[model samples]
Target: MSLAPILNPAQSGRAGVPCSVVGASCLLAAASLLAPAIAADTVRDRDKAAIRAAAQAYQEALSRGDGPALAAFWTADGDIVDEQGNTLAGRKSAADATKPAAGTVRPDMRIRETNLRFLTDDVAIEDGTVEVGLPGIAQPVRGRFSATWVRGADGWKLAALREDRLDAPSDAETLQDLDWMVGEWTVVEDREGRPEAAAGDKPAMEITVRWNANRTFLLRDMKIPAAAADEANQAGTLNVTQRIGWDPLSRKIRSWVFSSDGGHGEAAWSRDGDAWVARTAAVLPDGTQTSSLNIYSFDGKDRCIWRSLPTHVGGEHAPAFTMVMTRKPKGKTP
Candidate 1:
């Protein structure tokens, strides 16, 4: 994931900004209640900037693997308590504890400050999220950290710091990203509101997508006129049943498809920004194997476009095509 700054640079320092600290309840009383909040917040902003700058300094020290510099950020008797309940007490102990990481590959550290409030004029409490990008790890290690900063002659220092690891979402829960597919839809002309195909064109395909009883999976049933597709290449009504669910072994969202004819296939789904990409592999009744990459792009709440790239069948290639699907009205008929 891309990294964001601790805070936007434009947010700090309200110096020279115009403000009318006046209200209906007398000017003096209103000023008394409002001016201090603005003043206190300004002070907090300066403190936050100082701490942020100090954090950057420590980041540089970490890159150099300088254990002493890292220890200097804490007070002489500072305490670092980890999620496992282990403690690194005092500046010396902290320095010694980090000796192992010295001269070794260090992970990239990122901080996102959430809330900061001054306990007193010289001390403040901070809460934020921290992510460390470790070597050999595809995803960063994410966690929440709370730290108490004490202001001494040397400026703000970490007095006590604690962090806890966050749990990753389950595969089933991750499937919720495609929730918009659950609905009734029918193929329509890509140019206009409804189907207006030229005479003798392939018939529209009607589809209904819904959730299973427990809502863990989605089931989609669709129909295509024999003119569009038929089993055994014969003229007969063609129907397709598709089941979409999370695959735990592969850790991906996958769909299994079965047509009226003796053919079956499955596709693994992935998202690329606003569009979904499905890598599909199928087998026909005649033992011919096929593969294609299908892209689904939603136009709006009630419209979507499904486009299939070139397909490789046994030894031949099928041209690509695009089709628009519009959600059918709640109570409508063909």
Candidate 2:
């Protein structure tokens, strides 16, 4: 008789299923994985609801002129940075700043979300604009606002907030630095190979240099004298003054070249090893492009020499170019 084989308790379960003690542990682990997935979904839903509710409450508080209510949405140590990058930190300052607008003017402020960026499960950034009607202001003064929010057990609270005035610089102003170029100097240029000039006219033009208030920036105010036939147009020779200084931001020397003929140009100077190099970009009267480059080397005896590249505009290398100056002697000022 073909009788059914007695089922073995451990091995009789299913095909490919392990029957050893390790198998039970594996089965148990597989079942436990569902708990975390369920928990994650629940937490995500709650966080979403909390963020929405908190954002709505904050908006309402601002429109209602509720100082305490508005403050409630922010953390105790929250900070505010204005458009000019000036920061007002802590609840006290933030509260005080808000009070000005929350006063009797009765603002119709709205906080609609223009952008929402989540940094983590607990941190987020909200960007929008605030429009208010101040007394005597014809149009509404609208400024962009950004606030950082943090998650809490109750909901999301603002941790830091900042706003900016789009049309102007910040209240904090940065002073210019140019303290390395205070001295007297003279420029000597030699112009040759030009058919328009008489013999021995190939070289030599003179210029004056000065610096203001012990500044690093040296101003090159140069004058070009005209010859006998050109004396009638002597007033039209070259009158250019460049305010040169070092820019800490760009880590390069910069200059603003202003001409007496109502023209202007910008220049940048940087050092490559022992050589100082400069490139100038200028606009001509007819809106044409003019450029030049110079490489400078200083001798041990306080003399600076510059070699002009092959492209000058109207005076020297090509047209109006090249500069060299000797450090002035002591006790005599230029």
Candidate 3:
């Protein structure tokens, strides 16, 4: 039996093998043909392992000021990012950023690695903190850093690096007109009374407002805190949407605020004897209907505060909630 001849390109026209005798050789040849595929998988695994190992070593070299060692691990087009979100690209750029930081060392400084995610066999993302000491500075510079790596023909290179200052996550707030409610504020005092206590007596929520160029199309966002939130309703959030505009037909101001949750109501605002008064009405979550008369005025210091008195069933007055919001410093809070 000459099954081998079937696979040999140069041995065309060779006599065919006996079927019974060729079975063993046929199996062996099939296995031989599959050897390259299996070997290829092994090679891929080895390459990935090597890349990971190189990345780890490179990181260690940066920490220890092994410039030459670190440089050897990166591809020619590698990039680096500082903790302040500054980026330096290419081998030269990376070298410059690393070289200066590498020269300084302080025993009290702390550097920690946090998260590493592999997007693919050839791409990865790493995030961590870099704390370096300064000569006279009381505290070390601490910020987060991230790197995007790609496996190139020569080796693994950084495709991009983004560094951003690390800060505590801020409560959301409206950024622009129609920006919608997005910041944290609490109801410190309610003079008119509480219809029912907002999830918290403090009644903290976000306020957002949007306006168009004509100023006629104005939208407002109010978030209601969750009932169970004792600490200013950090967990549960409810939204209130309102639209305000001038009606040419009526020649007056018209607006409505609807609790996106269950409270739906309209508020009409106009000048009172000495200030602005707004009348509001909406249904509560428990199927109770109520109406509100709110008076707003600016104090001697020009701080705005609102008094809200709500009436329900047969015009019976009850205290629901009062809201006083201090103007945030121009650029202090996030």
Candidate 4:
């Protein structure tokens, strides 16, 4: 007697079916069933990429101050809930609210995606950080934003956007206003067309700014190799260690800088139009008191021009000089 399980012809509606034939049929059925699932996964991944692209477009529009372009990222009836709880309903309202005044400095806004979840093939939820600042603003506005994106005939559009202001910025949050400076930068003295370059070898300054482990402060280290070679002057190799942080007591952004040459100074930083103005006072190693106004203007993410106007130094005022710094690519040694 063969001890094999018999196939029920009544269940399969086929009689006298070979086991091999049954196995092949089952495999074919599974392939047919999985094909649609595989196709669906591919479609979902494409949709996610499209949605993220739309988010980037939205940020670019904001940075360009193009209110219409910004609005086009949203659905016709889309709504925006701002940090103050004011709602701008519909595309027109949202666009008008965001339109910059004539001649106003464009806000430098950056968006970083934190989370993205697909609710359906055509719908998704995105959470991100939005940091915005104008040239003269002491600190950029930092906020959290959550958006609902929906896919339609025209691709993904924001169905709703809600922004919430972060509680009074932590020490780290304020430092984030200068986050663009968190990198290695080099100043090529001769290339900058400055009069100081007429002197031999024109000193080059390398600056490195980095965040501490907790990111509460930005540590800046600046080195001028030429300064060290000046044997006659004790200022040996100008190395300055600086820390930038938010001072809660003063409710201001400040920086303290100490140089290897026994020079120490502090600056209160503020925004002035499209520039950052730092009013600085320092005591030189020779015990001479000095004061200056330093203005920093960013040309873009990688380059900034800094100008210093001396107000007092040895009781003599001096002309302002400008220095430009360009960011060095990561992992590149100066």
Local distance difference test, each candidate? 0.64, 0.53, 0.50, 0.67
What is the per-residue lDDT of model 1 for residues 60-107, given as tens digits with 9 covering 90 to 100?
A: 765554557767888877875553333445354335323222233344
> What are the root-mean-square deviations of the candidates from the true structure over C-alphas?
23.9, 21.7, 22.4, 18.4
Expressed as tens digits, the lDDT of each residue in 177-288 for candidate 4 is 7788899988654234453553454436889999999987899999978552345775456788999988887677889999888889887776654567676766668765
Count of clashes, each model: 0, 21, 18, 5
* Better structure of 1 and 4 per TM-score: 1
Candidate 2: stretches off by over 4 Å: 1-182, 190-203, 214-216, 227-237, 310-324, 328-334
Q: Candidate 1 vs. truth: CA RMSD? A: 23.9
TM-score of each: 0.44, 0.36, 0.36, 0.44
Candidate 3's TM-score: 0.36
Once fitted onto the true fold, the runs of candidate 4 whose alpha carbons sit more than 4 angstroms away are 1-173, 190-203, 227-231, 312-319
Candidate 2 per-residue lDDT, tens place, 1-102, comes to 432232344463644443554467777898799889888879867876777677777656544435566666778788765443434443543232233221
Highest lDDT, which number? 4
Best by TM-score: 1
Candidate 1 residues lying further than 4 Å off, grouped into runs, are 1-173, 189-202, 230-232, 311-316
Error of 1 at 36 (Å): 88
